[model samples]
Every structure is written in C-alpha cells, then in structure tokens.
Target: MSLGFAYAAGFVLATSTGMLTLLGSGEFPPWLWLALFAPSATAVMRARNRQAPGWLGTLIGGGALIYGTLVVQSQGASGVLIGSTSGLLGIFIARLVTRTTLKHDLQALMLSLLIVIAGAGMNSGVSYGISFVAYAVSVVWALVTRQLVEGAEREASLPFGATLEVTLARRDIVTPVFFAASAMVSLVVLLSTSFLFVLFPRVGLGSFKMAQNSGLPDSVSLRGSPMAGGSGAVVARVKGVSGTQIDRGLYLRAATYDRMTRDAFVRDSELVGLQRSEWARLAHHEDARQYDVFLQPVTDGHLLVLG
Candidate 1:
C-alpha cells in the first residue's frame, strides 16, 4: 500500500509538472490536455482489474515522445516547450517501468525526479513555486514510506516473492508522529534551499546573450496607439506616468517584418544571423534616452521598444 501511494504521488507530480509547463507556454491547445491526461487515465483503469500492460504503455509513451519532439522541432524549442516535452517523456517512462516491474517503487520515484527537473526549467510564476513545494513534500512522504516498507521487508526474513505479500501495520509507520517528523524535515529542507537561492548572486547577460524567441507569425496588426483619444475601450492600463506634457506621436516598435507576401508580412529570417557588432552598430544612437517599459501579456511573445 505504501509503495502504491508512492507511485500515485509520483504520477501526480509528473502530471502537475506537465500542466505547469502548458500554462507557462501562454497558449494551451485542447489536444495538449488530451495527450497529457489520456494515458494516465487509461493506466488507472487498467490497474483496477489487472497489471498494466507494459507493451501498451510503452507504445503510448513512445508516441507521446515522438509527438513532443515534432512539436519542439516545429515550435523552435523554447525552455518551457522543452520542459513540457521532457515531462511528457518522463510520464511515459514512469508508466512503462511501473507496469513492467514488480520492484518499481524506486524507479518510479527516479522518473518523477525528471518531472521535477522539467518543472524547474519551465517555472516563471508563483504557482510553479507552490507546486514545487507540494512536489517536495510528496517526495519526502514517498521516500519515508518506501524506507519503512523496505525495512519491514528486510526484517521479515521472507523470500522475495513472499515479501511482496507482506503488509505493514499503519500504526508502525503511518503514525501522527511519523508524519509530523517528515513534515518538519521537509520544511527545513525547503527553507534551507530557499535561503540559499536568495543568497545566490545574480548575473545579467548583455547584448550577446542567447535566448529563445517565439516564432513570428506571417501577419501582424499595426493597431492604433493605446493613448489615442476617442478609442473604444482601454486595452491596457499604464502606471507610473509622471512629468509627461508632450502632445506628440509615440511609436513603439514591437517587431520588424521585412518580407511581405500577398496577404501577410513575414519575418526576414536572414536578419537573425547578424553579428552582435553589426546589431550594435545598427542600433547605435547619439542621444538615446533609456527608460524601462513594463508590458502586459500579449498574444505574440515579442519585445516592444521605443527609439
């Protein structure tokens, strides 16, 4: 029963990681949710009557990995997308290994670690931090339970096959004291890690920094300015406006589309390979005023700047 709990916790963590990755992507497709949930649901249903079929699980997992790879290839492999794909693959492998092996408690936990790593990679919001804490607590419970179960099996002096049938008394391991101790340990570890993270020095990457950018769409709408008078409704609210008494046209360039087709403006892919020095030269200004711009979420993931 403890082993079963551990497996269930691991599966839940993996699912949560996948969900967080999808949420971080800022665009969720219906099929992505289906792909995430279908295999786990099927595995649960199969576990009720008999052992999960290893071959079937492997097939499902392999299909998901392939599909995730295709998505990364087509979508330009952002950190969140990479993490999402890794979580999916981890889920598949966890399911396959758990169904195939009798001594799979440790294996499932290890596979769940992959999901945790993926979650770390994809995290951007406060919710992911909460999920991280939950995952950590679950892991502590799983590990403690697994240790108790293994100790009990070792003490019984039974054959390996007979040990599988050995049952542990709830009072022996699942007592209130045990839970409190585990929770305390988990909390201490969490606090220590957070403290260390806070103390770590942060460094910034300058113009040559490499980061993934979302692929550009063919056409973009050059809408009217947000500050225009007689607009229908306010699309965004700007704060911290002070000492601005100039009545002039303000243009914020989000992206440059150099290739125009019959119906849409496409990005010139060649421009991306330009050297840092070339870009610096092109962007040089004799008297450029620098100010921070805080933009709310938009459909496309492009940086908007005013020159």
Candidate 2:
C-alpha cells in the first residue's frame, strides 16, 4: 500500500509537470484537457477491477498515434505536443496490460520521462523548473518503491498486506539514510551535467531563420494602402499611463527599407554584424532611453518597434 501510494504520487507529480509545460506554451486548447486527464481517470477505473479489453486498449493507442501524426502533418503541431501524445498513448496501453506488476511501473516511468522531455521543449519558465525538480524527487521515490515491491512479491507468497508490511520495515530500503544518499547521488549527477552544458560552445548557424519560417513570416510589407489610411484596425494597445498626455503623434517602427522602387520599398540584403559586447555598449549610452511595450496578436507577425 505504501509502495502504491508512492507510485501514485509520482505519477501525479510527473503528469502535473507535463501539464504545466503545455500551459506555459499558451497554445494548448481547452479540449486537450481531456487527453491530459484521461489516463489517470482510466487508471482509477481499472483499480476498481473495471479493466477494459486488451484489444480495445491497443486500438485506442494505435488510433491516437495515427491521429497525432495526421495533426502534425496537417496543422504543423509542435514536436513537443506530438511526443507527449505518443507517450500518453503508450501509458494507456501499459495501464491496460498490467497495473500491479513491476513491468507496468517501469513502463509508466518511461512514459513520465518522455513527458518531461516534451516539457523541456515546451517551456523554460521558473514554474516549469520547480515542477521538474519536484518530479525528479518523486521519480526517485517511485523507483525505490518499485524495487521494494517487486522484491517482496518475489520473496513471499504471503498476502499483499503482509508482504508490504515486511517490505516497509526493511531498514535497507526504507531508512532515511538510504533516501539521503540517493538524493545526494542524484544531485551530483544533475550538477555535473549542468556544469558541462555551461562549458559547451554554442553554434547559432542561422537557426533563427528556420524559426522565422516555421511559425510566421519574419517581414510584412508596410508600403501598401494600409499604411496610408487612418481607418485601419488597432494592432496593439498600450497601458499604465498616469499623467495627462499631450496630443502628439506616436510612431512605431518595425523595420527600415533602404531601397524604394516605384511600386514598393525593398529591404536591404546587406548585413552588418556586431559582437554582443559592442551591442551592450551601444545600448547603455547616456542618450538612450528604454520603453516597455506589450503587443497583441498581429496577423503578419511584424513587431512594431520605436527608435
């Protein structure tokens, strides 16, 4: 029973991490909440011996994978979302196969790991970071409990209550000393990997161009009739002004075009490169002023900046 509780707690923590990551993306649909909660809900039902047929589980898993692939192809769904859905489907199938076995626990662990991977891709917020740490600790507890449960089941044909009671009393497995050692080991591994990552060299290699192409266009033509009209729709809103304002015109610049032809203005292809330090120096000049801006959704993905 203690082992089961640990497993349940770990599963919930890991699942919450995934959900928080998706929430951070700010693009997850409300309808997808059902998908997020389905596996846990099904697990609860199965716990009451209301297990669905194996074939039905297989069908659901296979169909979900197919549907996820189709969604990716048609709607250009995020890689993280696709991977998460795949992992969820795997868990669904595993849950149907066996709930009380070590194999099932391991399967759930792997799926939870997959969800964490997806979460890393989806968001890098502080909340996600905290949730990830919680998940790591929970996983350690889960793994320890799984080992204990499996060992006890193998050693005795006694009732589950007796086996679990014996297992819980084992000092080697359940002692504070063991948990502390495990935690320290996990911490060492984490810090070592992070240190290596910080020391690694980064290569940008035009990845920003790929990002520009994937979601929205990087540039939009401002040399059209839309620029000449005062009756256009509002693109952005500014707030937090307290004092009385004068009736001066406000100008927001997105990009500058150097060459103006008869029909349109074309952007210059020549690029000027600067080092990070140089940019930082330029930004901190005494004549410079800073403003914070909030933006609404723009169809063309062109951000309006001010000089």
Candidate 3:
C-alpha cells in the first residue's frame, strides 16, 4: 500500500475506535485500543497484495466486527452492518483518494492526514456538531498550501528502512563537515534544553478539572489468538505444593458480555453482585488447586503466575 493510504487507514482506525468509545454503548479502554490499533494497522500496512493475507484481514476486520457486535448484536444485521460498514468505508475511501506513487515519507504522512480530515469531514455524522471542524479544516488547508499551492518539489519521504541503504560513497565530502558542525550544535542545544528542564522548578497551576467518566473497558492484546491456528496451550508454567508440575493449560474463562445496543456491545459493566462474586470465588478455588501442583523455576512470562 502507498504511505498515504497506510497512514489514512491508521487514521481511520484511530478515529473509528475513538468515536466508538465516545458514542457507542460499551467501551474498550483507550490504552487497550491503542495496543490493538498498533498490530492491526501494522498487519494492514504490511499485508502482501495480489491476495490479501487472511491473518491481516482477520485481525483488522475481526476487530471492527467485534466492536460492531458489542455495540448492537441484538439489533440484528442492520446495526452490525452499519457500524462495520462505517469502519470499512473509512479505509476504502482512504485507499481510493490517495496517490499510489508518492515518494517522500513526510509528504506522504502529511498528505495522508489531509486525506483523513477531508474524508472525515465529508462524513456528516463525524463532522456534524463537532467543534473541531475548524481545526481539521485549517490543518487540511495548510498542507495544501505547503505541498500543492506552493509547488514545492521536495523529494517524497522514503521509509526509514529503505533510506538506510544509501551508500556513503555518494556523499559530497564538504557536506559531511557541514553536517558534523550542525550535529554538534544540535547536540549542545539538546543537552542545554535537557538540563534546563531537569533543573526547572515545577509548578502546578492550581486548576483541576475532573475528567468525564465513562464505561469499563478491557482488551485482549494481539499476543495470541486461540482461534487463529494457536496451540491453545498454557502461556505460563507453575510449581505445586507436592513434587508435581502443572502447565498453564486446562483453565478456561467464560465469555464476558458488554451492554448491547443496536448490534454492538456499547458498555461493559464492572463485575459486581453476589452472582458475579460467586463465579469469581469458584474460579479462584479451581486455580488455587492448579497452582499447588507445579514445580520450581516456572517460566510463565508476565501472565498471572498464581502462587
């Protein structure tokens, strides 16, 4: 994919995720959403063309589908289709409007942002009654002025990995000396700023504003997926009370359901009530027994290695 379209798709994912949190029923926390976005976008960006990879499609499309299902599963196909379509449309439009042959990375990034804002604004649901429209418009206009209206012939930005391949033999000798001096000056300035920031007195302006409260959010990191050809084995190992060893498998969690509207899970409730606690207690009892049978020096990564 072109850099412009790649960036545009990333922007759409971010925007859709944010909007879902803001306007939908249940919620996935921002941090988890960010984690999800990273791999999902990377998969989409790096996916081989000709025939798009199933893993890429599953990660990105499945995520959006899950979000849609959470929002309105009960609302039937209409609700699911609308939410899913909205996300898919954002990507489709981004790919359609971007030029494929842009050379510069910075320029491509700027152009991608421009495309996102322009495309987003065209969506009445996104732009309507939003105070940030002016900001979006100004950003778009500035890029057009710089890259298009101004007629700058700057080289299209190259991806970092590809840029590293340039041979030093191509360098002009005088340019090296000039660049060295510039680098020294830049290093000194950076050190001075760092010193000042560290030594500067920190003060809090006495103004405190409460953030708007929202729903409980959770996410599964892209570390593993049992449905995606995984071994579904234990992620961690454990030691037991006796001379026994217990692998981190054989335990399963019940599915969690979020508050549904239309076709998606819009809000997730905090686990509460006697029924919830009872379920938790029962699970705890089972885990306690499992943990008591593992051996020493069990390597479980960062997963909950229960004692």
For candidate 1, write residues 139-179 as lDDT tens digits. 77767766766766675675653353344433343656766
- Write one digit per residue (lDDT tens) for candidate 3, span 189-307: 64576566656524221122245233344542222233312454444343443322212223322222333344544324443222232223222323456343232221211122233
Q: lDDT (0-100) at residue 291 of candidate 3? A: 42
Q: For model 2, how does the per-residue alpha-carbon lDDT over 1-307 read when each residue is reduced to its tens digit?
A: 3445544554555555545554555455565556566547655764565655677657766776776676677667465476456546445444534455568657766766766677677676786777677667667766776676677777666554456556644555455675677667667777776666656524232334443443434444443334323546665554533222211323344544544555665665533232233223212223544445464433232334432
Off by over 4 Å in 3: 1-58, 62-73, 77-82, 89-128, 131-135, 138-307
User: Candidate 1, clashing residue pairs?
Assistant: none
Candidate 1 Cα misplacement greater than 4 A, ranges: 1-28, 34-49, 77-80, 83-103, 156-166, 203-307
- lDDT, candidate 1, equals 0.52
What lDDT does the true structure give each of the candidates?
Answer: 0.52, 0.55, 0.37
Q: Write down the RMSD of all candidates, one decimal each.
A: 18.2, 18.4, 24.1
* Cα TM-score per model: 0.52, 0.52, 0.24
Q: Rank the candidates by TM-score, best first.
A: 2, 1, 3
- Which predicted model would earn the best lDDT? 2
